[model samples]
Target: MKLPPWFRRRRVGVAATLVSVAALTAVMAPLQDDIGLLNEGLLLLLLTLVISGTWGREVGIFAAVTSNLALNFFFVEPLHTLTVQSPENVLALFVFLGVSIIGSSLLAAARASAEEARRREAETQVLLSLSRAMIGQTEPAEALASLCREVVAAFDAPGASVLTAAAGGWGVLAHAGSADAGRPADAQERTMAEQAASSGQITRIGHTGLGNSRRPRIVAPSGTQRIREADVGSAFVPLLFGDRTLGVLRLDGPIGATPFAQHPDSLLAAFAGEAALGVQRAELAQAASHADALRQADEMKTALMTSISHDLKTPLAGIKTAVSSLIDTSVEWSDEDREAFLATIDSQADRLNRVISDILDLNRIESGVIAPARRSVHVASLLDDVRERTALVTKPRVVTLDAGADIYAQADETLMAQALVNLIENAAKYSAAGAPIHLAASAAGASVEIVVSDEGPGIAARDLPHVFERFYRAQEGSRRVKGSGLGLAIVKGFVTLSGGSVRVESAPSGTRFVIQLPVAEQAKASA
Candidate 1:
């Protein structure tokens, strides 16, 4: 139970007066003979000043009255009586009382000022700490929860909870302290939260009649009526950000136990404002992250469409032109001319097939569906297969293969041959006309290294890193080379699936592609 304000004030004043009088009495008794009336009066006045500086005006006034009465009864000429012996004693007693009252009043004002300054300092520190804690948080829900815990601790409330307005109703974002003690247990308490959030004002339940105002009664669609302050016991502070009310901060404690209810509404509002800004910052950060991801995906989609369109159009145009020339009877083509045109049609059709196959292979590899079937194969045999398949397109360019006898690699032969074909074709397109393209294999420790070196204009330093990426082509000298840009990407995919590695070295002299495949243990032992 809380005591009435007037009663509590009187009790504190009476207690301070009694203690001050007792201390003066105890000190005056031992020195009464040695200390004259003037010394005794000064001692009692000093005691009153000290008491007044520690307590406030009400207690200070009481101490002055007690000290004046005690001075006359114990230290005046008529000892142990409230009577003065002469005019001089009367003058001395009056002077002592007047000085005591003025000194106590001055000291009391100074004490109240000091107390106020200390209180403001404490409030500022709490606000600073709360701001620091909220600023470092990047998630909305987590930041709100941390804010609630800080508020509860700062205000020394029994319990506190933060509620956010949602589609269904008020949702609890975070709670601190006992669940039963801090949260709304009845519909009336929840109504208070809704009222505060909707009105953007501080709402209180079970408050003393100070600053009480009636709000319009709220009625739910189900016919539930809002309860007045007499029926509930809590305080609700709305968190407002700009023009929007974000939520309500609910505080629960015994009647008159919640410090926030007693504090100025502006202070609580300031705290709510900080929390609202923190939540808004976190929400904006999350939205930016999501938007960035969507932008990257859209860019990838656009690039894929553009690359596929160009790759398909080039081969389709060639095939169409060759077919048109062959079927035109009006032209009266000779046998040799017809044979050359037929070969053009066949080669263009084959190029189209290869383009389609590369697209499918790249998709399969990226989706992790291309599982290689490993086997032991001779390096020389693999090189021959690649040379034969690529000879049709890479004519006039000499392809050489150098490998030791009986040297075998453990890999998927079909995938390995495809990888080699891509490397040889790439080398032929970029190298000098009629330049020799070298395909050499050597045993290095436990692996077989296949090196494809070309006497072509080497790739630029900047484009080397991204050469293995899908749809990436060397921009410096690749304008004349016709390709779908999936050749090296496919080679890298196949080599990786076979448990091998591929890398390239380029300079002004030449470009070298080194592929390392694990050698069969038996073959390595024999070598």
Candidate 2:
């Protein structure tokens, strides 16, 4: 038959004590005439101390009583009887009993202290492992999944899941262990979870009758309530960060079996709280990243509008003035004057067209649609074409080119010439009327280098970095000179597309813009 736990626990100690008492009494009974009662009592007392030190206080007490009874019955004056015939023998038996009880109590207390220390150490290790797993996890869902796995392993449960607060209701973020672990909590289960979350408390619902029914109940802090043992399916631990409840950790196993039932409610609740802080931190980081992206986009939009308004108005104003002068009938102009005015109209119209074209080209380049058609092109010939096209703007300003007849680069000829034209135009707009603009090209290693230098006031140091940005005009130079600010930007975009690079160097002496493109295979073979 199955015995109660109390009896079962002491069974081995009881048996051992009984056997020791019987043996000691049997051996000492033959020597009782030679040895005194006090000597026999001392031998029995030593046996009682050994039992108490090994089997704990309850069993120790049982051993002491057994030893005392044996001493009185077998060793005292009334030999083999349950009575002490002499008063001095009675006092000696009582003294042996008292010493055994005192020694057992001390031994039992020491054992309890060691056991408590070991339990605390195990709990500390579990918590440390959990903290390590959660560190550096940026995603909230990923962090929650790690926490669930750690909890399941720590408690030796079948499965564990975390339910986070979602838009409509609770959403399962992560689960570990069994396949069914991640399933959405049922209505009743969710109710229990919500109760724990709302109240910032831990709620356990399972068959609690199997364990200690009368064990000391765990009381929660103010604003929290302790969970009592009840017939339910699982335990709901609320993940709380201060007054805010982030989510709930739902732990469960097979039917009629609660694996986490053995764990203390307070410890599980504390673990859930740490997991909540991790989730909160991850969510905050994500929100911050999103906000930064939005801010940058808004700033870009504002800059685009401001640039478009300023650049578009300059050419439009010129065209409007020229057209208005031509249509005026109040003053009749001579043939020469009419031709000059017509020329002004044509040139201003062309400038407006170029502005619109630059806008379209920039849009295509920024959207990754510009694909250069590269081929071997003579660098001298390309410079000649650009110089001719920019004759109208460079007439007053002297422009000179020094490039070898055979210098060739692998690039889109049309885009390459356009880039050179933009650079020359920018130089002309900034340099004095009589100042010289120098264009030089030569083969350097496997690449051809083209340099456009102008005798103009140097660009400011702070403006150099942003010189190639779209719609970026130099604060110092833009005020004195008129431009759409798209020249340098277009040059950079076209050169980059042709598998080339462009850079600028500005000093007190002058500003130099450099362009480098790979030498063509045919050109290298020819050389």
Candidate 3:
């Protein structure tokens, strides 16, 4: 709406105040006593000239004319009037008045130009600082907060803060100016800030309500004890990493505080992007390192197990042969002595053979060789065979397989038995030998899952991720139980060759190993 006449007049009065001092100084210039005040007149005139553009060219001209009239009336001899007294007075008056006006205007204009240049420079500096801080930050949090703080300080804003978007809500992270009378932090404000942030909207609140009161955010105050709650102002700059909105930059300050001298909206987005990329990189690196370590450890364990199996078998086989030769058609000592010798040989050979077999079976699986093959075998029947074989290593765990009409998995029966046997053996080795080892199989969708569960101390949390890797005995402490770490690795490789996947889940109760394979077409048809 157009201002009323009175309001227009009032504005004119306000504008007149800008140059009134210059006008008065010029008016006193003609008085001989006021001659010294001419310098004051020049100074005032200069000030007026400097700020002249703020009003307009008309204001500037009025200032110049007023100063000249005052000089002619008050200082040129006959005081309080605009009459020129004599020729010398005329020249002196005109020269003095004209020089002052011209000089003032020129100097003022120059100063004004310099001031403009300085302001532009400050803005450029703000932009540069904002740009670097934003771009350098691959992680958005610290940088965004710093950006707001630095920019506020650079532009002399009151305070700075930032709010970011998070799952289900937002997070408020801010810095304050000096204390003032205001509400202390509370959950209410936090919730509001978070909600606004999640919405990815620029929120602002001022002393006089610049924006919605529900979620007022702006250039908030910096460090201070007492903030006048009424004077609080806030603003939110949404952090956009790409097409997605990553978060928001929420800040607040005292009322009337300005934003960064030159607000660079684009810089905020850049900082968020950097943060996201850094976080992603860190996660990927961790995953890759874990996988690599497991692979190396498994390889080492496989080699060691194979060597041990071979070493043990060689001596055991020789001993067995020598004992047989003693028993069969050879000159012998007393009956008692021969019997004792034979018994000892038999016991030792049996024990050695069991150990050698376990090692060889594990090694063979790791070396990618399937065991002795035979005719069609029932899953239940094969499990029983495996249970018997596993008894030689660690006593049979509570082995169980459904009595269903011999569900068949097409593979070398012996190899399948060996794989299952190894798995059972491993469960016993890792846990107490007598632990209830549960085995279950079921047809789920198109695949069959065979899960072996042992009630032993679950693997260590740190080691759980690598339990399948050979020689990875869940820890680095006293490794009392010795084994070719190849058991699990072999099992894994065998199961994989049979076209399947294996996974281990360990919790406080016990560790569970699950193997899933695509059942043969016939098995699927039955299901």
Candidate 4:
């Protein structure tokens, strides 16, 4: 059996110390006549010193008293009696008693101090390890589990658990070791933990009796209770932070076990303090994360309002002005003037339709309704289709495409084509009038790469990372672009859903958007 920590090392029990003294007396009694009286006194004193050094001061004192009486009755002048008959013997006895008691006291005190220092050092190490483990832990359940593991390892207990008060009452947040070890084995343990948390004091529950008669009982503290032998079965330490009792840390040991039979209040406090901090950190992190989410939602709402007010209103105003002019008959208008007015109405109406379409696409993407029907799509044909569709948007600007007839990509052709159209339109809108917009497709390893590049003023370095984020637009020179910032975001969503990835590279001279899609089997086989 493993000895209790207090009894291990150089310490022994009272019963063992007495038995040792008796054994020494038995061996020395028969040699009383052969040994000198003073010499006998010295041998007994030597035994007192040895016992005191090993078994501690209290046991040493008891040993000294017992030995002095034994020496007088068994070997002193007055054999088998308490009376001393010689002056020299009386003086020797007094000196021996004084020396034994004083020497033992000093030696025991020194040993106790050394043990305290070692205990403090070990506790410090445990606290340091626990603090490091808990640092930067944002998840509440994960933090609690880490604390439980640390407690079990530090005490060598059968198990440890952390409990917190939730809406549904007390719940075990996390546990380590034996499943039942941390749970309340009986109602008494539950009561003990409740008492600890309510009072912010350490409480304990203990088991006593034998066989089927064994029962658990509350051993809660009137004040702060340290880990005593009777309180070792289970300990409920309140996790207190400031004025709040955040939770309880329960430590469990097997009945009759000695590994955790004795522990100091300071050591328990250190662990509880760290546990409280971990819980508080997790709570704060959760609050911060929730607050951030709400803030982002508010920002998105504001951006949407701004887009509607500027982009939608601008197109509507142009259409309304052109229609009102066409209906007025007070002036005889030329055919040229009427034609210009009709053209303005048509272009502005198209612009309004495009904006509404972009908004609907963004909604679908965000709502997770964009599921692509994957198929082998010829790259050359997809590029040609996109170029034709965006001819109006890229008017007056030269557009170029480079794709081999054998190149094909695994993607939904309609989604991929729409994604490319957005890129081409975006390039044309930002670049100088007539600046060439180039589209290319090539086989790269196991994927097909589609590139759209423009000799436009490239995106600012600070804006490149967030370009694909919905409702985000980089300022063009001193003014923001007049459109919903959903084009690039839709492009990304569609490409991602089609089993492809998109990225952009920009410099002061130009900008390049690259999309990579899985290469179709036909393309690989044909190559």
TM-score of each: 0.62, 0.60, 0.38, 0.69
Q: Provide the lowest-lDDT 10-residue window in model 4.
A: 208-217
lDDT of each: 0.76, 0.77, 0.57, 0.79
Per-residue lDDT of candidate 2, residues 338-395 (tens digit): 7887787787778778888888888888899877898888888889889889988888
Best model number under lDDT: 4
Q: Per-residue lDDT for 78-181 in model 1, tens only? A: 88889888999899878887898889899988876765676577678777888777786767777777777777767676666777665556767677766654
Lowest lDDT 10-mer window, candidate 3? 255-264
Which has the higher lDDT value, candidate number 3 or candidate number 4?
4
Per-residue lDDT value at 16 in model 1: 64
Per-residue error (Å), model 2, residue 217: 20
RMSD of each: 9.9, 10.3, 16.0, 7.5
| Cα lDDT, model 3, residue 223 | 47
Give me the overall lDDT of model 4.
Answer: 0.79
Best by TM-score: 4
Ordering by lDDT: 4, 2, 1, 3
In candidate 4, which residue pairs clash? Answer: none
Report the Cα lDDT for candidate 3: 0.57
Evaluate residue 357 in candidate 3 and report its C-alpha lDDT on the 0 to 100 scale.
71
